[model samples]
Target: MKATELRHLLEAALPEAAHAEQSDLQLGHMYLPAGHIKAVALSRPVVVGDRGSGKSFWLKSLVDDTRRQLIGKTFQQEELLSCEVKTGFSPDVDGDYPTPKDLARLVQDGLSPDAIWYAVMVHLIVPESLPGNLVFWKDRISWIQEQSETVTAKLRAKNAELHAKKQCILIAFDGLDRLSPSWRDTVALVRGLLQTQLEFGRYSQLRTKAFIRPDMLASPEVRQFPDASKLLSLAVKLEWEAIDLYGLLWQYLANSSIPSQSAAFRKFADKVAKLSWDEGSNGVFVLTQAVRHDENRQEQLFHQIAGENLGRGKKSGNTWTWLPKHLSDAHGYTSPRSFLVALRFAAVDSNKRKFAGKEFALHTSSLKSGVSEASKVRRHELEENFPWIGDVLKPLKGLGLPARKQDVVIKWKKAETLSSLLAHHEPVPLPEAIKETDPASILAALEQLGLCRLLSDGRIDFPDIVRVDAGMTRKGGIPVR
Candidate 1:
């Protein structure tokens, strides 16, 4: 088949297989899908992630499964409905924007139109909107008390109606905390809605889950929520095991291979069926066995084959011996979701090259390329949407930091500094001799920025998906090139 056709086939096949439940454990993409189930069962759960981290995919799978159980087949649903609710912010702009009073009215309208809008304004906004007693707030508190009863009645009536319906109304609010000029006000508005409804038992059934990225949670605005931590438990992050990722890939491939339609697919499956990672304990490894066999037989055969390569019982020079030795340096696969993406790209390359029946081998270049692409996209998105990391890097590299006489003298030189690289969240750490400025402070700031994390007693490193440029290596570590 042509590369284009193979690419489509691999892309289609991989996700189905890797994303399957039974396959998830074996391929290392395991995750607690129970959290999602609990969220739906108990309260509205806000799910969040940086783009390309499979946020939509996870939710889609959950919803599809749920719908399948209900309707006896996966629902033909559009993802746009979820997308709109999640991402509802606009960048900052200068304007006499809507006030808390106006926003409160909007909520009142959404909740219960029976509440006299004027009464709501008097109860909620009057306290802060009086002619400056210079400090007019004190003067309007009395006015607020006067209208409270009328507004309260309306709100209660609305709550009663919602309760009578026996509906578990989940208002999933996603991406509102993303990059926006009005993000602060938007969050405050959401909090206000939660607080208001929380008081009434009738309104309690209508829960709202706001999905927000981790960095966004660091905002002082969010921190102001005394219950931030508690509320955050209702939030979900997409963390999957390596096995889960592999399962998803395998299932995806199995479905896409169209075994019933293609001789090539059957051949491919046969070759992969008996494929083994190493030799068996009896020491009989075969490099050319077909892989299209049944599951149990395939696993048994692979183990036997692997044990053979690794050597019988106590034999040395086994394939397993060399396998771990090679994998040790490449074990930074923190999440199955990321690893799955890299695997998909590799499968595309292999399938396109007509290597379906060939032995499984890691394509380092393709893996690195896929990871690099994904990381860059994620980083850009995180930075753009999450201002809560506000000036987190600024403490290290921005204009406010103190500059030395030598710094100014050599500032125009071609050399890069620890601070500069850190600002970009680059792979390698700054070398000691080169870090002349407040090195400790810069390092701490980088950690705060989540650009680098402490790995051991004192060693620091970037997250797994990010990598050092080819020629660069960790300080004092051997270079790969």
Candidate 2:
């Protein structure tokens, strides 16, 4: 119960939550909500989500036999294993997918994006069945370029074979944003992929899944396809409900390194929730039955770490809902990555502060400090995904939020940083409606990115996560922490 002892216990019990894109799939601890279960079960061809919402994680899980077996226990979808999954594109350069430069070259050569995807499928399926020289990717590309009809016929034949065997193929395409140099080309490629998926639907044994970002899905170019609405209708958005988030925390704690804490937490969990354990290679723990939103179980568990209130006062605010709400974006979306980042930082902060023995493992101040750190991480992600937005907002730093649009425009017009950033780097996939250097276009770009919102009151509001990182104070000069 001593502060030092608790700190060590906390350290042992809470390993840093791994980002899906960065870490190998943790099959045992994945918390799949009902919506996700439906999405995976239905095998929807298009899964759309915001960045860090576990699209890559889900795709990885689907391809993993051990993970799929574990998932099969809950969903009773053994047919998932019948499908051979392959990555058509991903952020991992070492992955089987072709590089962006290769894709760009193919586009420049006037090769249809759909043909390129089919060639990827051909590369994945029965390479030995084809000519020896065609086995290699470069040869395969050349072959597809020269004999497009032959490649299509081969894929159709393969589909027929799989169909006879009562099996199917799921070719997953992720990291589409990285597939081309410009937004225009990226959209064209994605549209082609979607079209291919639609065309392949008649085969009954060939299925494709595109894990895409929200911004890409919202782009006009992708939506302009004639049957775009049909693909959109089948889209499943990856989201985490309140119960799912709490369930994730529990799952993490149950698998903590500290045996005593893990055992104790499991015992506590057994009393109030249904628990499942994977009997495979990983032997991971999963929460099969989640607690209700109104239940105090989640609160009790977190209270052991973060305490009942953010402070000693009655009005200090409850700790359970505080973390997620504070970490949410402008659209009220919070990814699992952001939540785990905040929790890890809270642990780090608590260890540094050395709270009193009477206090919980994480202090109120430490928790708030975690929010600030998480904001920085989220900001870094934004900068990487949309570098131009970072440049556009640089001049507005130190300004307060909820300011009039005209005032924001005035400040943006006065800032020299925007021009400098634009000179050094062109906006990736310049919007169709606006030039990169246009000031009005920049504001529209910000709004589209969900970094800021144009309020009904004629003011602009930034989400706390963004507002904090941009060094923008609140309207009343309130501090984020």
Candidate 3:
């Protein structure tokens, strides 16, 4: 087949949902990594990840019956198929839980954070028992407090009944960062939720899972409590390995969708992974276990299309490894969404080449172009969460990479980068790292964000993706000239 045809197919195969929104409910795009089984199974109370790591995606999937059952097939977890999932919190505003305003007001009303979260858990687990007449959150929390014994008894009874029926319930929490713009409120709210999850852990049939970010996990204020160490010890990070990233790529291709023609890409994908497809109920297609965990098989299969020599200028490379090597963050983690975005952009960029009868589906130049394009996406994502990042780094544009750390700091100082971010989330609380605005602190923050690399020689290195996106120059990680 021609590269053009395959490129077109690839462009259609990858999903564009880079930002994991709760509304993304496509069953076909569900590619659960083996490591995430515990997180999705609700066995782990906390799921930690950075942006684009599928935290919110899995958060929404827990409440989705179709998606949950599909997750059930991947692992032998019983609660997955015969379980009740409730949204304890999410980005979308709904009456199921307290809104940010409600949380703020509840705190101002002198209600303890633990009490507020416990009331929310009670509402999720036993909604019928919560007063139907209570319209406002404060009133409902007051009622729950007044009837604490009754509520506890009801929850215990519900758990016993679920045990009798061999079913269970999971109260899922996501978007905690959105609960309050104030960092203080966020810490209190998260600490309360953690306390609530620990209390619920006593019930085998009732479980609670909170999907959070890495920074929150590292925050001492949030995790301060009795036995906080023991409860949070079981937290899992939704990290993507190179093999897992490629596995997800193939999964998207194998289960690629076009309205009314669901299985159209199956044969094309068969030529790639050569794995059996399990046609589950409602025709949701997923690959057999052989495809997800087998790193050797994935690489061998990928090379069948990516060709033998992806490098040039008297050097050799494997596209299977090269793609991720060029795209990963400074910490060596690549987002599934970023990987797909790079491939999709590379496919589209390769269409300009018209490499008639070219053996490879992607060209080296196009692959580089794809990385550059995906970095733009990454830049936007970084800006979206940390708006200060763009302003801080703007002065370094056109500056060469592997530069001295002091040089970069001088530019940031000259630009007054710290002052610009001081007012970003002002009336509302700023996100993490805003308090530490010194040049040295800012450099550390950038390293934590995976935007810059710290060198042992006291130099700073920018990943090719970030460097290219920032219009900075780098000399390595490409074919040797």
Candidate 4:
């Protein structure tokens, strides 16, 4: 292919590489992560994952008919289609779940959390079945509190009817971290929902799924209930293995609308014996099979995009492992969102540089530059999710990582980082779980957020994903190359 054609192909083939936070249900293709295959198929009640690990994506997919059908087939389970899925809570404005303020008010009213959830079910499943002329959610809540037994009886009857038809009602909840004003209240609500799920287990036809962030699960308040271990035991942790990431990349590439671009990608796949087609689709191909590890094929696939080495030649570390390793957090977790963002930016860089003679779409310099772009995005995401972390870290921009705790404390004192953070965000009650008023508490919070690691040697280390974007250098004051 000519330089211009390849550039166009690079642009067209990798458009919008990152998955949207709110995934579109209409997108027919999904790369089911191997670790999550069984979890999704079994309908686990509590699913936990860090941000960008596809909790929302899976929840949205389960509610989408076409995507649900495809996913069901992937697991070879027809029962997936028998599910009547409803979103109890989501970040999407149009989602059915009540707002955080409404939930907070309900909790404050001393209404039983279990009863509140039952009321939500009544609203979704069969509003007419509810007693006492309770049409709205607020009214329904009052009625449930006033007549708990009656509401339970009605839900039981409806569950029985669905059981007879061999169907199940699956209610999903996400965005729990935003569902309440304080950590205590959020935990109380989540505990109630989990207890309700346990109680409903007897119904056989009703199931509840909650997508919770890892931090929320780790909160002591959320796990204070008597039988919290049962829910915790059943929780499915959403994870992405390296191979899973590659599978996703090919899945997107195979679905490309540009004929020549798709053709070129397929040709590249064939070279590594990694290309296969779906049964019915004429031109659609499966790049890498969804499995635990296709090391050879995955390595080849990465090389196709990022080339054989980090730069120059094989002497420069292997590109296959370098991309994800550099993008990973302190916990060694690299989200699909981050990976895709890097890929997209790399392609854009490759095209802009016009490296036509290179064997791969991404040059080493372009790939490294892509990592830098991804780092910025990841930092912004952390800030949005936990605004306090940004406030704490912004003052330490020029400080080097893998430094002693005392060094950080010195910087903290010099910059008045903690004092300013408390001052600017004062009077807005901090989440009871996160203590940001002092230096020790701020460092602890940063460690929990995976923005930095507390080394056993009494030093601190920031992951490349965070350090590069935060403008922090490594030990010895060496800047990121």
Q: All predictions: root-mean-square deviation over Cα?
A: 13.0, 3.4, 3.2, 3.3
For each candidate in turn, the TM-score is 0.51, 0.87, 0.90, 0.88
When summed lDDT is taken over every stretch of 10 residues in candidate 2, the lowest stretch is 271-280
Error of 3 at 38 (Å): 1.7
Local error of candidate 1 at 370, Å? 3.6
Q: RMSD to the native, candidate 2?
A: 3.4
Candidate 1 deviant stretches above 4 angstroms: 1-8, 12-32, 44-54, 57-165, 182-202, 226-230, 233-236, 254-337, 351-358, 361-365, 386-442, 445-450, 468-481
Candidate 3 global CA lDDT score: 0.76
TM-score of 1: 0.51
Candidate 2 lDDT tens digits, 1-481: 3444444555554435344247554544576666687567635888988877878777777777776666666677776867777777887524566688888887887777877776777677656545775544556766766776776777788888987898987778788888887666788898888887777666677777888998888887777777878778888889887666777766666676565766666665555333433333566665434343434666676676677787677577888888888778767788877777777677767876755446666888777777777788788888777776677767778777788887787887788644655575554644444455666666666777777788888788887778777788885432654
Of 1 and 4, which scores higher on TM-score? 4
By summed lDDT, the worst window of 10 consecutive residues in model 1 runs over: 84-93
The candidate that wins on TM-score is 3
Highest lDDT among the candidates is held by which one?
3
- Writing each residue's lDDT as its tens digit, candidate 1 over 58-159 gives 433333433313221112222212221211111221222233354444444453211222322333322233334522322333343465675456555544
Which stretches of candidate 3 lie above 4 Å from their native place? 17-23, 92-95, 259-265, 268-276, 313-316, 354-359, 422-438, 476-481
Worst 10 residues of 3 by lDDT: 16-25
Rank order (by lDDT, best first): 3, 4, 2, 1
